[model samples]
Target chain A: MRSRRTVDVPTLVREAREGSPRALGRLLTLVENAAPELREIMAALAPHTGRARIVGLTGSPGVGKSTSTSMLVSVLRRRDLRVGVLAVDPSSPFSGGALLGDRIRLVEHALDPQVYIRSMASRGHLGGLAWTTPQAIRVLDAAGCDVILVETVGVGQSEVEIAGLADTTIVLLAPGMGDGVQAAKAGILEIGDVFVVNKADREGAPATVRELRHMISLGDRTEPHLWRPPVLTTIADRGEGGDEVLEALDSHWAWLQEHGQLEERRRARAAGEVQALALEQLRSRMGSPTEGVLREVVDEVLAGRLDPYAAADRVVADLA
Target chain B: MRSRRTVDVPTLVREAREGSPRALGRLLTLVENAAPELREIMAALAPHTGRARIVGLTGSPGVGKSTSTSMLVSVLRRRDLRVGVLAVDPSSPFSGGALLGDRIRLVEHALDPQVYIRSMASRGHLGGLAWTTPQAIRVLDAAGCDVILVETVGVGQSEVEIAGLADTTIVLLAPGMGDGVQAAKAGILEIGDVFVVNKADREGAPATVRELRHMISLGDRTEPHLWRPPVLTTIADRGEGGDEVLEALDSHWAWLQEHGQLEERRRARAAGEVQALALEQLRSRMGSPTEGVLREVVDEVLAGRLDPYAAADRVVADLA
Candidate 1:
């Protein structure tokens, strides 16, 4: 059952920790596939992950996600911090093959040893995090990367899911993307820990930012936090005002810590991680021996000899 | 710990069956809450649910979901069938109120007893289906109803989940959403058994239908079935061309029958319904004695006393 291209867990973990690009690439593949050896790899490098501040950048397609991500990387590196970027793209609708074009726009930083970038796609997986994105972040985090930026295709639900995976969630909006703000109403707007009004050089930037601030204010009138998520305006292509964006994020993080929201968010995230791991294991175990017992109950339900709900209860009871 | 006001489950079930709206309303409320008595009530009503052809109608907002549903009700009544519509709306972001606005737009059959419309919101339930929506559908489906339509707030994931609850899924789309035929990428497009090009009086009507047809052709290249999803055009607001839409649907349904897809779809839908029920029960059971067993393992995980993967193995082993 062994595959020819096996992952070298220990060596890859060591190299990834030493900032080896090849090692990081291999580890991301392992994580994306949910390979059986993922735990061994992650455990070997867990010490390095806590150092990275994971920032998720998401917005509608035309809102300049990659540009903002690049700007953030440029700004963080100016402070002498190592930055890693994971830009997620949607696979081709017809071919099912991904076009890793996000990294092409960020190719200017390819020569910088302090910067690392990887582009990932949904890979036909449903439950949120691009299968490899989280693993890649763990690898980069363990590699002593000071900052990790996750850029997601911002078509709402997936974007919100990606945003949830990060320590700091940045929802980007651009001027003239009118429908973009309305689309945010679904669930994305609620997930924004920090909002970025990117492409601030354009018209209606002030109005768009004001509108968002007003909406947030209206959402929670009686809450104590009174936190109007700062809308930092930036022209990412020009690298103008990138420092202020980082400063605003730092301020938000500090405020969250002071309010104890940071601990609560982390706890919820850990719970989600645990649940996801449980579900993944459960899905794989569907073909295991226990499932044979469950199938017998299902057969009874199918034959109309027993109620489906009662049958399910019996199966779970048997498992218990 | 019991409340003073206990429910009369049998009487409510009897009244609900006898066309008493108040009793039906009360029953729906209980189901929405998934009260302790839910299992007994549903078991009593299970025999009544098999007759209705439950259809789930979904798409992005402004694609005329409510209007299309109104047209559908009109078509069903013309054929002398009793119809019920359930509109699932999420709570208002600010006020925790139901918009219920989907009902107002369906003006054509407002006076028909054959057409019953109900609106339910998330009401703090975590799963996509408004807890009341499915339960209400079951009640209506059992009460000699011929067709049941479930319309979800066009915001993405909830609608897809609604499709799983429906016997046949109709995905509505407008001509110029500017989604660039990436329209089908949202996972909703993939699940559509029938596609409707509403607002077909618009300029891009033919082109959009052609685009969709192309997508469908690409999807079914490998598997040849007698049932091909035909594209239909409609101007639903004025009820213009509603008959043609119905014709296309009938043909599609007949094709499904001929190709055996109809029975397959129903069997799959039933399985999904049962699984969703099981997941809901498991979710509600969280923090119970069942969860108390897992909590200890989770605590060990958070404390770093045990790794998550190892803990998952133990939990599964314990469950087995």
Candidate 2:
């Protein structure tokens, strides 16, 4: 493969596999930019990806998503497992990019070869998942990381979208942040595969936990898959109770594997790759010269001069 | 115009203008479904649209957006101004169409001839504003409405995109919805032209307002046109202080008009129409025969045989 002197994909991939921080950084940038050889590189790397246990973290802003992720990464690194983090930042309206200052919160991990952290800008994707997210995850997974954690952009709907993308989703809630119970009512309570009462040291902690436990108990018990999604309490900044968090992760992974759900999830993720490629291909093809015929069909449909179904059929025939 | 047996666009538009509830209901459905000739019909109806002051209500779910918009509409109706409401809802994940049930909360306007309401689905667009929105605005705008209110889906970057569309964007905030200040810190806070401390009857109302005011005060003060935006208090559910909300709206609109910014804003909105058409055309062109060239490009790119820019240029060249 043709490679630039400054950014060699093979060298970067190899170094990242060997736990080189700078190489990991370069690899992440290539993935985010959707580099020329992204698909081929990612395809080559897919076999290595299924090994990493993916964790999804989500909550409203200032509920300490970055801080909690940092502590969790530290705990994973301490266990001697290499970790990769993908933190998704909400985009800025003026700049059309993410204000990712949250990355600075994890500066402690900068020198730790075992930990690789990358910030991803949401880039106006509707679902909380970034448009490039699944590809980014594949890149991290192929780079030989033990665990890959994805942090959502902290809006309720985005939290739900991110939950769907991960094997285990943690919905973070804080005490005294106002409307803790209301947030639960608005869909966060339903999407969480695991609930984290973050900043547990704050006032109203017990009440929030008690309320959450009560809510969880009230939920229908029709789908128990070995481990019940637990409500864990932690003061993330102090690195307290992170071990319990790890236990929860391991238990959830084990539960999925024991139930054969892991394979199901992997199948779904693989299917997503096909859909992404189809969408990309579809978008690119829409602008071709042959599009003149389709443009006439659309104009006629909009003008009531042509039937929509008939137009669709004609286009399909033309494709054939 | 060739008229349908059950619903005729011109009749519906004319009757809806005369404060007919059934006519408004039928018209909204036509627009939301993006009925044929909508663009032409809307352009024909633009003059009547100038009467209503459009206000955009947005925030994440659980922030009381519907309640706030309902209250604001109620307050406007009390002043005898005809009000039209558009609530944008998430399209069904499975069906790829919007579930209009989100508007169930705002049915208080159902029997009022002075108020018209419609719900739009984003149809899997992710966070970008739906294609049907502006036309729906035009249909309501033309049918002799006094004020048009657009309520966003309140998820992810939608709040910011919606802000750009509305004449006056009022971002609603509830006291207890997690990270009181930080929720406003991301893309949401930056785009809001005006802030609504919704659920002001709640305990943390004063603090939320103070915090918002502080942030507004600290922002760049050089653009007097973008002066410290106002933060208003409202118990939207109870219809309390909504008159003050309208007063703020009046003042904000007057400010834009006095400085000749109103015309500029309208001009930008006009330009938005052409951009929207392009996007709509793009969606329609997908899956058509013209996509053959795009498929070839993708094949080349996927095989790591062609650069993305080169592929993109080839497609653009065909269009030329």
Candidate 3:
């Protein structure tokens, strides 16, 4: 039954840590597919995680998130920090085939030995990014990345989900018309640890920055001991203002550590991870509602012989 | 302990069924708040549900969804069918306060006793639209609306979610630059029961329609016995094609009935609703991870003393 790809999980993990991008890629492919071997791979990677600093960058589609990610990557390379970029398209599962288009702009460091870049779509059917991204981060982390940058596409619940995963979450914006209100509308304002107004060359960059700061102050971030998010501007396409962006990220990282919030965030992430897995286990045990006790309850609920809450109560009691 | 607003649940349901919009609005407010009375309200409303046909209209911003919904409401009203329009903004909770802006275009129906229009936001903390929208639909259905139109704002996952909730789903598009490719990219191609090119008077209407038809054929909808989604043109702002859209909707509804898909989709929806409620119950029983058996398992997972799957198994065992 052994094949060329079945190269043993421990050996693959060792190779990944020894700077073999092919081995790392193979491991990530397993994660993406939700392979049966993941239990083994995660057990192997578990002891080696918790070192890389995970930073998440999110914005609306037209905002320069990809370009800003490139700018940040080059900056991290300059500092001799090993970088891992995971560009996640929460909206589309077909994006795995289109990585060449996504990565063409980052060809500057495509050959850099210290830079490990990959793009992961939610795969649509394989659970969700909330479940898979953290595991992928673990893959990159155990592979010896000093900093991991997660760039998520689209907005709404995905941004909130990304914020929960990252130690430092960056919300990006541009100088487009009504972009400030646009940011507020997407609920990104509440989740960001740092705010970046990209396209500084545009007419309304400063206005956007001012508006963001005012909005932050007006919110409950004014409470003492809580980190007040900083608004910075960048022309990411030209790689201008990248160092300042890096500086702001480093400052936030430092604040998280000093306030002992890093451990708190990581613990919260671990809790969420465990909770999702536990729920998945319970769901599988309940079996598909296509048949079994779950199906009977659903039928009863449909007939109005039982309320959904009562059906749920019955299912939980049966589970016990 | 009963406040003035604490009108008894069964009486409220009765009043709502007897053409009382006030009673209906109060029931929906209960849904938005996840009120303690919801279990009672849902039990009371369950028998009267499943009679109304729920059609979901969704598209990206500026695609004239609200306008199109208004046009459809007029058609439904002309037939003397009681109409309920629920405009759900899945992206923000603050949208409840801005109903005036959303409803201004629908001022023609402001005085109609038979037409009920309500805007529901996810309210951020109130579970999610998936868990709460069904209850709201039941409120509309039990109140004796013959046709319920659900218009969702934004796109991506929300479109898929609306598709799951509706008996038939209409996806709208505008004739603009790259609008055809935009439809393919958003993953909405798979979910539409009927496709609409809303701004048919615009520059690229014919091309967009052609592009959409070609894309539909390329997809999995060509299977025998499957309903092929029709691409139609409408000048919704002028209300030019409302009757054709209504015809298309009626045809799709008839097809669903003939194929028995209406019953299948409702069963699937009921199963999902019950599944979500069961998971919520289990999560509450597990309690907070701040301190509990769950906290211990999370700590173990963080320390790499236990893999996530193993921790999950331990937690599930503890639940039993």
Candidate 4:
């Protein structure tokens, strides 16, 4: 709803690049909503992107995703890397309200100045997680973040989409989460670059690790130089095994760079973003359900006079 | 990929209406792929739809969804009602090849002629499960099926989409499936009209039921006339408690009619179908990654010469 005249885009972008978290947060909100200055802001930030290592962490709920993310932030800070965290909460439909637990866990980095944590709710967005996430990542990347961690619950299409955005995707599991079969069923097996079994102190930790390995081995091996996803264990609550997880992520990044997969992945990500934006624009141009050519076609479809496909084709032809 | 010339649409519709399973199956396939004659086929079938009671069954893997669906088909057939089943397998991206286990279990109804079981894989389809499902339901509805059960794994966006298509959505859970928390996490609690805890013989059955009831109670109840979802127990494998499950489904259907929610749900479903078709048409018009204005804009965005939103606007304007 914020128009171009209401906010000074150039000033905000300059402030954000100069280490103003408040300015950076404002810029993120602008990009997240596809505000009027989105293009202008992205143009300003384009040169600064393609620097941060974007790592996506996904797992089922109750798999210590938040804990693992918080631990990673701590470890990354220990390595003196500027980090940004985008925790996408698909559960809540309302934006601007962060989960209480995540807020408390991330409070450790509240005054760090180098670490920026933002929780984005996937609500009221037509294109779902894929639409807003890339823009938000661009904001972090442009803000001089060395690494940006994109965390999502590895249960749905959103997780698959997050895979497309991340340089290295980490699929986290836990003991007794019924994750092996669940992961495969959700199509997470194919997207994961690194698998982490958190809560390693639990009873079924070893079994979960073994099951993930077996599933990975059974996966399609048609690509001769495909990176084999490694299964690692971690007790995130105790901050144990964080180094191994980081190592796995670093190794994946190295592999991508060595094979020139990084550029390919980034190109694919940009292509996806372009397609989503174009489709969203077309939807918006179609207008509301009560007026315009789209409405007329919809009415025909609803009245059984014209089928949906034909009506759609007619609308597209009219637009053309 | 079958063109209109390859098959006679009117003959297929007529034979399907006259209780030809092969004809009905062929019609289902045509609708599933959004073939060229889809409009003609739907036009012929529209009048026969809006009669069959559509029920959706969803749960995690190993929750006996196929077994429960077969049992429900058996029970419905025993009650002298023709039944149709559309088992949407999101796990498999290849269509036509139905699961061996489901095919074997459903072979009982193969010779009966009163029951029709079809499995649809979400394969190579840009729109995912939501695109083809309603049309497939229409095929069965026009074929004079009294009840159509749409079964999908309750994991991702597909289950949420299936909820929109079904008049009554039944979320099936089994003991030790970790479904109580998983259901809440997957946002299934809001969509389920009837909750069935299958495998009642297991140790966690009572606890799962209690947990589900508690979760349902915690759900938003601002609307005083809103129907409260009931939690039922069933040992679907042994066919025990099948009658109770059927009764619950019947009660929910009657409730939907009495509250006038059925009309509202159907109208919403039609509107969604129209929107999906229109979006799909636009996507096709945008062409593939290497051709058309879409690719040109994508190239610009990837090269960082233009932001995605700006490029999208240019594409939309070009089409306009």
Candidate 5:
């Protein structure tokens, strides 16, 4: 609801790029709000976008996702990389519990100016992640982050949606959790670019890894040109296997570049963003009745005088 | 992809109404495939829909959903009402294991001509249940099903989506599975018209029921006219508590009638159906580029010559 005239977009973007954390936070807040100034902000930031390599980590509730993310953030920092962490949970909606817990676990890097962390809840915006995520990623990308980790406390569809925003998606699992079958059932296997079986010292780590490998082999991406995801183990709490995970990420990135798939993926991501935006515009138009549009149609539908299909047709025709 | 000429929508609809199960099955198949004949089929069946009472039953995997549904179907049959059962697994896409299991558990009614059961897999269809269910419900309603039980092997968002189609939603839960918190988190508490603690013979049934009531009490539906859901316990495998569930359903239906909620819910369902169909049409039009619409925009996006927001504006403007 913030007016466009009150906020100066160019100065904010400049300050954000010049390493003012307040400006960066304000930009992301605007992205989350889907405010009136977002179009101007995005237009200003468009030139600086597409620089950050986004890595997404997703798993079920107790798969050590945040711990692994924190561990990975530490390792990335050790390698002198400025990192931005976007923590989102698809299942625990509208509540701060999950995002708060995610932040607390990663509190180690809170003081580091190079490490930026923000938690986004996919509560009631409908697409959960989609409506705000792509724009938020552009903000972080423009803010000079070398790598942005999109970590999600996800259960089902949100994980897949998160993968759409990421350059490389990591599916995290833990030992002895029936994680493999659950992972496949959730469709995480198809979206994963790198697989990590965290909690390596736990009972069923090797078995989980073996099951994942066997399933990956059975996948239809059997052509030699495709990247076969390596299933690695990590005791992330103890910081044991961050190096291997990072190595896998680098290899996937290299393979993406070698096959010219990075360009392909980026284009697809952009197309998704464009399509989502167009849909949003169309949906908003459908909502606002301009001289007897949605209101009359809904009334007729309620009276059974107009079937819903016909009602939608009327709405769409009136979208001009 | 069957040709429209081959499928006579009128004949199929007539046969389905006259109790031809094969015709009913074929109609549902058409819905599932989203065949070209769907619009014609929907128009033909629209007059007959809004008749059957749709009761959605949802919970986690081992909460005895199919068994409870079968029990309810048998009870409805005892009252000499034709029944239809739709079994779907939102978590399981492109496979038949869960649906097969659902069928096996409901095999007791397979021999009854009055009871029709169909299993739908939400595979590859982007909207899953949204694409197939409304029309499927129409087919079953026109097929003379007085009651339709929508049983789901749901985990996350599908549970919420299924509630949209139902007249009265029943959220099933087991006693010992942290069912209360999980149900609230999965958003069943808000949608459930009746909460059933199934498998009541378990050790913690009382505690689960208490927890559910506490949560229900905490919800915002405190108005005196609103229907407060009762927490019921069921040992469905033994066929116990079916009468109580049926009685609760009857009371809720009466409440819906007295308060005119049934009409509102049906209209809302119609509106949702209308919106989904409209979106689908728009998306298809977007996909099939006439004279270089999406292709050029995507190419520009890939080249970073145009930002996705501007590209979206261009696409929407080109839609005319």
Candidate 6:
């Protein structure tokens, strides 16, 4: 085991690129920490990015997300492609506990050098899941993963964010998880590039797929050549329908590249990442609440002597 | 119909405090916009706040959040106390449609002059739902609403945020909502001050409450004096158990005051609001993508010449 103090970023990046899992894990940790050497590592890996096909899978809980993800990994591995999985759970603080379960589920890939799986908890990070996920994807991409799968439980702002990070976003649904109206209310209908009705053997599977298709037809498709999200059925636990899902994903990627949307999407992703990082840096530089202008303003706001808006103005003026 | 350009802050504040619903609505709109006159309005209303008891209601969709909120409003008004409701839907862009439903359910109080209801959509705002919510609460507090209820769907980061804004947070669950495990997974179990199993007439009500109690017992209570969340049953549709719910809220409020936690909570809330506003101001100052250093840095990032972290550093250095 390398001591924390002795771990070197350049060496780790090189080793990761040379297919060392330990080195890749170390590099991921560095990126997750937004380490001091992040700039050096990212600059080194920039030339190697934009090669991996990034796919995001998200849906409500109990939708067989884990089972579907595991099945997808198996299918991809069957083709001898290097695959990486980042299972991000934003609500859980017990990363170790969830990771153990994930490991058990993906036991087949546990010893496979070509398949890398990791779980990231959203706690203890200054920039929630959104800020950390892209960097993690970049590390996997640079480490030569052919297809990187990013899966998150579809609830909250994180689901929308995963859409921005992935080249193709697959939204999973299960029978009796609620009707199509509920899905629309959750805002998942808008972000999905492809919808999967997992557990197709269940009673309401056909209804769920039909509901999704109906909702998609009703959605705003103002773009002349907008991609219509396909609703597919899958019995993930039985490892059925993986081929069809893969076909849909590949078709989406092809359409994106053919329409020149791939560059546009990546550029947008890069811009968002840059903007978020810049904002986080500014927040960090504002310093802690010990004895700064920020603290003073907070004190005033707390005392009700100054409004939050005015206090914010003072802090901004002082910093700028 | 008052023109936006001619709305006077002092006059509006005075009228709102003097019991004019129109003035109160206008003040809410102003605060929601983070208008130029926000400081003046907040300073004027500062003395009037901390008088209203703030209650937050959150639960999964189909868990009767809207019905329960209306029922709670009825219960509070029976005491002849004025009430205000802010239905914050962070996912929707069509605020007007949702507000119409709220108004219909609250039609009994539509002309009551003592009850006010508004829906805020999270769109076109730099500061998200968290930042805008407290100011809106302040408007209701200043308008002399004896009780203010803030309701939000309990799926995302917003539920945690609502806990910070409310003096008491009620987490509602209905029967067959996938057991208590789903509640725990949603991260609501930790933040709930009081848990309510709504739709008590349903088949699985007792089991749901039992599951909640079991989960609560298993929760880690590091603080010796930590408050134990009480699980209660309620048929909100029929207004059953409203008195017990009210009593629980009152008891919790008393506990907070006796333990001297009220001041600490309010101070923390104020600090958070201040911090969020300051961050928003900084982001705004970074300017739009059309021009400025921010745009230049984004261009570099998109071109892959400069990594996001380095670009962020340059922007921060330039601004600071």
RMSD of each: 4.7, 8.5, 2.7, 5.2, 3.5, 4.5
Fnat, model by model in order, equals 0.11, 0.05, 0.53, 0.39, 0.31, 0.44
Give the TM-scores of the predictions, in the order they appear. 0.82, 0.65, 0.94, 0.78, 0.89, 0.82
Task: Considering the two chains of model 2, state its CAPRI-style docking category.
Answer: incorrect
RMSD of 1: 4.7
- Model 4, position B193, has a per-residue lDDT of 94
Q: How well is each residue in B61-80 modelled by candidate 1, as lDDT tens digits?
A: 78898889888888888999
Model 6 Cα shift for residue B238 (angstroms):
5.7
Model 3 clash count equals 0
- Write one digit per residue (lDDT tens) for candidate 2, span A200-245: 9999999999999888887764465544678999899899878888
Q: Write the per-residue lDDT of candidate 6 for residues A226-312, one digit (tens) a residue.
A: 999899999988999999999999899999999988877786687667777877777776665546887887677666678777877
Q: Interface RMSD (Å), each candidate?
A: 5.2, 9.5, 2.5, 3.3, 3.0, 3.2
lDDT (10s digit) by residue, model 4, range B33-69: 6678887888887767678899999888788888888
DockQ of each: 0.20, 0.10, 0.52, 0.31, 0.36, 0.36
Score chain B of candidate 6 by TM-score.
0.92
Worst 10-residue lDDT window, candidate 6 chain A: A93-102
Which lDDT value does model 5 have at A196? 91
The window of 10 residues in a row where model 5 chain A has the poorest summed lDDT is A90-99
* Residue pairs in candidate 2 whose N, alpha carbon or C atoms collide under 3 angstroms: A126-B126, A126-B127, A178-B176, A179-B176, B17-B143, B52-B146
Highest TM-score among the candidates is held by which one?
A: 3
> Pick by lDDT: which candidate is best?
3
Q: Which stretches of candidate 2 lie over 4 Å from their true place?
A: A1-7, A91-100, A103-105, A126-130, A224-227, A288-320, B1-82, B87-112, B117-128, B131-147, B153-156, B163-320
Which prediction has more favorable DockQ, 3 or 4? Answer: 3
Global local distance difference test of model 1: 0.69
Extract clashing residue pairs from model 6.
Answer: none
lDDT of 1 by residue, A1-320 (tens): 34648667888888877878878877776775667888887667654545677788888878888888888888888899998888766332222333565556688888888888876655534354634565667678778888888887665356656766787889999988986578556555677878888889999999988888877766653477745577778989899889999998888778777888665555455455555565456544333322464556544443445444675466456444
